[model samples]
Target: MKRDRSGHFLMAQNARVLYVPTTKVASSTARLLLAEANGTYRPERLRWTDAPNISVDQGIHNLEVSGLQYFEFLPETQRDHILKSSNWWRVGLLRDPYARLYSVWENRVLLRAPSPWLKNFQHKCSEVLIDGRLDYAASFRKFVNVLRAEPEIFGDDPHFKSQRTHLGGDQVAFTHLFRVDKPGELDIFATQLGQRVGMKIEPRRLNEGLGLKHLDVMDAQTASVVEQIYEDDFDAYGFERVSFPSISPIALASVGETKAINYARDVTARLVQLSQLARYRQRSRYLLAQILRNSGLRRHKKHR
Candidate 1:
């Protein structure tokens, strides 16, 4: 898939660095940081416009990272090649699945600040706004359910896409993948890149939509659903399943007085496993085809 590189990805030939942004993972800061490294960032034009009605009200805006000149724009072919080559320094920002989901629920589902689809999602789910606000927990429950059923819907949106998807999953790899929990790594990355490019770069946090209502009392069923949905994330990043309060194991489900919540969790978990297996099988087939094609071409050239 061709990504919008200007804002979603970053490059610095001087630093020989490429950065892929994972939403809610200090992506705004990384974008500006790389833009500055490439001399395209305009801090003066950066303004915080908070019109609650508009999505841009929450984060930094007006910095056209792509419009500014850069050492290079990383194209799909080039990015794929470079990520696999050790010669080029590749980096990406990743977050803990649990923490990232919490942040998404707080800022995106509850506040509906950036995502256009999310604005009307609550209404579609019969979650009416009370004094211009819907219950965050109820909205988040719906959000998680939808995502579990249709993971493909998240492919285009960075906020909801799996970190593996952004980092090329099993298709391509990065040289240095940093975690959000380990914030000091950002500083380390900045310093390393600065030395490479012969410039000074100071890492700073940007667009942390904090002060929003944080979910401190998540029930067991919701937690189970999240764990199953983000199973890939947990396995890929070596993250442990975080424990949240589960009021009653059996009370999680009762669907109009039908199946138990635990039953739903089991189904979601199995589905996620099957999806992962399918992707892995597909990747294996792709690799085998490439190998065969390359071998045939080599034999033809030898005969010639």
Candidate 2:
């Protein structure tokens, strides 16, 4: 799971659709939709009673909980068929490189989202977290610098890794590649996917981690580093580059306000995660059940 090419690729065999999820590109929304199509999206299965909907929404990333099929788990013959057959709609979602990098900093570094991989980042770039305490701009710049020094150090953790790494370049031959940043693209996809599945399929959005714009934190130096890091994405996706003014007082104030609110949210989420971990036996049983279900050792009827 920590490797550069961990098996994040998924597919809906019945729908004849293959999905290559690029992190931070509405990938969660796409995964939920595909799970629905596969008749395996069971919100009740999450069993996090405190906030059922939110917990289930976030759980879509788990292949076992979501009940979606991992493309890598399929047989070679089946994988070949899905890739070659025109019947299968191989889908991908893209985002602006600039926007995507900023999101990584804002959500993972700034908001301190509760994730297992988060600790690895903190240990590697402690400066980002320490500087983040007082100066958001300096923290972001430090993060970009760390990323430039060792781009693949996180082992292709989806959040910090390039979209190109996940997309499986040339081998995937994605039939439908949509830019999530573009207006109405996801809506169009929703309609198309709904028609294919014979039901309404709305793209579920989550993790609106920050209200402040990327320009608020990013400066010329940080922006330049981001460009260098993700230049391939801009060229391959044909996304136009954007410029940012060095500073904006109004935006800076907004960043400060948002930081305070997000800090509280992050602490709450971490406390919840800790609470779950406290129930050692219950947590162990739950994880065992999930693994059994995912590995086909236990029977779980597909949800439609």
Candidate 3:
């Protein structure tokens, strides 16, 4: 479940832009790219000292530094201004719901890096933890059950929440929107967005390593259930249901070898998660310094 991920939003005042983030749709990569464009992103990935949160350096973050603020974390005054910004570019992204859930399963259960609320969710679902790991195959149906049955429980977690709602639902405030499943649409949006922001944005892949097989785990019943669960996303976003490619049972029926493969896959997933922290740290410090300098000048001019 590429869930709500602490329910964050990104903004870049210098760029006259606001971004509403949805998980498993390349939100992290978008955030970094936006920060770089705003000229305030630090190369180093720092810990969030304010709470038990793993985040980029908060000191050089926010509206002051990066011109980006976490929507849910910001004060109401700031949030209201951004959300209601008609003049600014309000943007959002979406992914196929099935794809998002599969990524979530790989990231949280296999990779062992999850949002804070995910553990509680795991506890409520099936597949008892075995040797500090979840039974990935067993969890999908149960997870979908939870998605349908107790939607309110997933209200805060966008990973599993409807993309329609995360992208502002029927209110539909976004001036620019993109879909991960459609590369051509993404390219068209990126080209136009770059012209508006006065910089080239070559969309880079981020937060991906999982294969397409996540969707195939769905049997007919589960597929129908998920389609219903995310029906809003399908309708609102103009997306169609994905018919995952089915593999023959004989090919996947090797029980002993499958166990080994699952273990290896899980181990690889964990390594990728660990390396991302270092990757975040390597962003250019020039961006952060530029925002600080320009912001200070703006404030000084206002006073004068």
Candidate 4:
């Protein structure tokens, strides 16, 4: 299954919490709450950086770095227990499909969010990357076109992939499912999770996208295309088709808006590249230290 390889399902074995985190769905907040419950939320992980794609609580998505366990890495017996046991709290979150797609466009295309898999999109849908620049409306339209054609071929990145695929299909019987759009749904989930984990858990709004409503940019044609693309999401998650604004061919991002957005994208791309290089150097230093320490130990043992 895609979920097995995607590593979206995280397990807090100590608390018996199985969390399936879908991107752009309050997933970062969910991870924080679960990490706190697991007694593994590292304060040091919270760092200020301009790495566009890295969350504020950095490396929380990484199973090794986040101090969280992957569901797939668990033993078969334990996996069976999580799936079948009533004691385990299996939780999943959902979002409106249209809103989710807009969020992806704003962050990834408009804001030029950096990711390892972003190159795939750039290579395949070259229109999104226009003349070494990102034009907001043009990028979004091109992205929708790519989605309409063959999203499966290159949309493996969790941020833009189908939420249904992230859920691992019918086999994942979630004990608690919350919709981000529905009133009081997340609050109810917080209460249930707090009781289970023996701590107050609040779902905060982390990672806010650009301040623009999806309906603002969504014309009838774009809405129709998006609905078709995410039809499965609408059906599976019970998301009603939202009404689009009356504007035909929604106004493009203003010239000032476009300029500022492209500038931010350029800065972010550079910062992310620097961040990755810094991390690589840090790892090299650690490895060198380890080698020196081990060599010194071996020499001492030989002398003894």
TM-score of 1: 0.62
Residues 1-304, candidate 3: write the lDDT tens digits: 4533325556676776778777677776676667766766654434422221223432333344344766566676876676676777888877877777778655654444535455455455544334545445556666777777876654455567677666766443677777767657666656766787788886656556444355446765667778898888778767777664344111132355446546765665465566555455544454666677788843333664
What is residue 61's positional error in candidate 4, in angstroms? 3.0
Candidate 4: Cα lDDT at 278: 75
lDDT for each residue of candidate 1 in 158-255, tens digit (9 for 90 to 100): 67767776665654466887776674878887777677667899877755653432244256677788888877888888877767666622112123
RMSD (Å) per prediction: 15.2, 6.4, 10.0, 4.2
- lDDT (Cα) of model 1: 0.59
TM-score of each: 0.62, 0.78, 0.64, 0.81
- For candidate 2, what is the lDDT? 0.73
How many collisions between residues are there in candidate 3?
13
Error of 4 at 176 (Å): 0.9
Model 1 misplaced stretches (Cα beyond 4 Å):
1-8, 44-63, 66-81, 116-119, 124-139, 149-155, 212-215, 248-304
Model 3 gets an lDDT of 0.61
TM-score of 4: 0.81
Report, for every candidate in turn, its global Cα lDDT versus the true structure. Answer: 0.59, 0.73, 0.61, 0.73
Sequence-dependent TM-score of model 2:
0.78
